[model samples]
Target: MEDRLNRIESKIALSEDLLEELNLMVFRQQQQIDRLQQQIVDLHRQLASGSPGERRDLREEIPPHY
Candidate 1:
């Protein structure tokens, strides 16, 4: 009976540790998601505002070797 109780206690401890690790992993992922979301929002604002300077000809973008 004592041996069975020890095994159960050990399993519980391991489960608690795994739960903590999983929670931390989820928190880090959420932080990354938040940063990506903010970047997307900033990009949208920049596009809506348009280019800051004079427009260039598309031909100018071609490589000289072409």
Candidate 2:
């Protein structure tokens, strides 16, 4: 019947819309993850290089009572 066909078409349209929204969300999440990964790499490089005025032998500061 025509009524049944109309209902099926409406359902299909809704499903397509939902799929598009889900794809957009996934793309945004992937962008954020990429940005965070880059930030972590930059932090690792900074720590490895050490900062100005930093002492390399600070490990010798352990108290005699230890």
Candidate 3:
């Protein structure tokens, strides 16, 4: 009777802790997703700003060697 109640209470506490941890994990993942989405938007804008007919020179991308 009392022992059963204690076990149930213990289980409930563990479940609550697990739920909180899961919620925190979800929140962190959402933040990362939002940042990634913003980065993608920025990249798209950068690409769109370049002239459509222009070709980037490969040599221009090379780092200068001393």
**After superposition, candidate 1 runs with Cα above 4 Å error:** 52-54
lDDT, candidate 2, 1-66, per-residue tens: 999999999999999999999999999999999999999998888778885347758787898899
Tens digits of per-residue lDDT, candidate 1, 1-46, equal 9999999999999999999999999999999999999999988887
TM-scores for candidates 1 onward, in order = 0.83, 0.73, 0.78
Clashing pairs in 1: none
| Alpha carbon lDDT at 34, candidate 1 | 100
Candidate 1 lDDT score relative to the true structure: 0.92
Q: Return the candidate ranking by TM-score, descending.
A: 1, 3, 2
> How accurate locally is residue 12 in candidate 1, as Cα lDDT from 0 to 100?
100
Clashing pairs in 2: none
